[model samples]
Target: MSSVLLFNKPFNVLCQFTDDLGRETLADFIKNPGFYAAGRLDRDSEGLLVLTNDGQLQHQISDPKHKLPKTYWVQVEGQIDSTAIDKLCKGVVLKDGLTKPAQAQATSEPDWLWPRNPPIRERQSIPTSWLKLTITEGRNRQVRRMTAAVGFPTLRLIRTQVGPFKLDGLALGQSQLIKQTNLLK
Candidate 1:
């Protein structure tokens, strides 16, 4: 039998269960004895993270070959226009290569968005809007970098879903044991 854990990772919390630098980590939230993260979420980002005790299950969930789409609700520092959406959907060119075509659309801010403790930096002359994007690949800082590449730097990032699982009822720093029976193709 395999076990899956769903965590609503809070902003600035290291994704790792352990941290050598004495920084806050998943340990502060998750006390499961044998579980491990499937993929890492950056310290600045928040929302759904998956963990599993089995190596093969973890690999299956995180490997890009599975084509599991991760959805992110992004607040960026500018009015996002259709041009940006078109570029993102067409696959923006990055230093590495052209990113796989992704779904990018502007959306209203989510209902339960909480204020970050210290909050994101704001410029007197700049404005920002929320956008939702879904992508199949998980690259280091990919969402932030992709948005920045199109002249809109991400101010806050919240991953809302990974495949069929989501941060549905979870709040900041909350977690629950998710039964494998609920997993979807």
Candidate 2:
């Protein structure tokens, strides 16, 4: 039987199970052997990270061809307006290329959120706002770049959901085992 583990990765933790640099990794939090992360969450970002023992399941989650929608709760450095939101929805051109159209909207900070260990820098002259964006493709720092391209640099990024799985009910650094069937389309 295949086993899936939904982890609420804490900020500053590496996505990999092992690290040569002595950085905090999934191994520090998860002891389950033989499971690997489906996709990577940057050390600076935090939230739901899926791990599985099945290669097929891992591929399905990580492959861009699957077009599994990943939702991010991004806190940006400026007061995001509807125009910015629209631009993000329409897609933004980055150094790599134009990104696929994404679903984006302004939102209040999530109530269930835990404070980052070292909180984001705050500028008294500038304000910040939150946005929820769902994108089908996973590019390197794509969400951060997309927001910056629209003139709102991302201060904090959290992946709240990936396809059918979510970070709902999970606390920081917590993990729960789930059946693979729960992730089926």
Candidate 3:
């Protein structure tokens, strides 16, 4: 049997279990030796990261062909409205060509959220808004680009969910392992 771990990675941490630059690594939190990250979370982005001790299972979870929906809780520079939501759900055109259709809905901040270190610049005049977006594909900086294309630059990005897994109860830099079959539910 394989082990699947769900971790809520914090901002500014490398996704790898080891860091050659002497920075924080998964070893700082997760002690499981054989487990490896199934996919990547850019150092700039924080949230749910799935890990597994089985190589084949790692491939299945990280591969885009699996079409696992990756959900994000993004805070943008300006207010978000129906028009922006529509464009995001409809797909935004990026230099990589048009993105795949995704689900987007206005949402509120999670309860007991902590402020980011060296927090995002606040434009005293403009307010930020939260939006829930689920995309099956992961492109480099895709979420940031999509929101920017709609006139709202992304300020803070957090991956709140992945497939059947949620970030709930997993604090920053903490992880919990679940049975592989749970992914199907």
Candidate numbers, best lDDT first, in rank order:
2, 1, 3
Give per-model TM-scores: 0.96, 0.97, 0.93
Candidate 1, lDDT over the whole model:
0.90
- Candidate 2, 1-185: lDDT as tens digits: 77889999999999997899999999999998889999989999999999999899899999999999999999999999999999998889999999999999999999988999999999999999999999999999999999999999999999989988899989999999986564655
| lDDT for position 91 in model 1 | 92
| Lowest-sum lDDT 10-residue window in model 3 | 176-185
Q: Which ranking of candidates, highest TM-score first?
A: 2, 1, 3
**Count of clashes in candidate 1:** 0
TM-score of 3: 0.93
lDDT of 1 by residue, 1-185 (tens): 57889999988899887788999999999998899998889998999999988788888889989989999999999999999999999998899999999999999998888778769999989988999999999988999999999989999999989887798878888888976642544
How far off is residue 95 in model 2, in Å? 0.9
Best lDDT goes to which candidate? 2
lDDT of 3 by residue, 1-185 (tens): 77888998888888887777898877888887789998899888888999988888788888989988999999998789999999998999999999998899988876757678768878999999999899999888889999999888999999977787788877777889786553544
RMSD of 1: 1.2
For the record, the alpha-carbon RMSD of candidate 2 to the native fold, in angstroms, is: 1.0
Choose the strongest candidate by TM-score: 2
lDDT of 3: 0.86
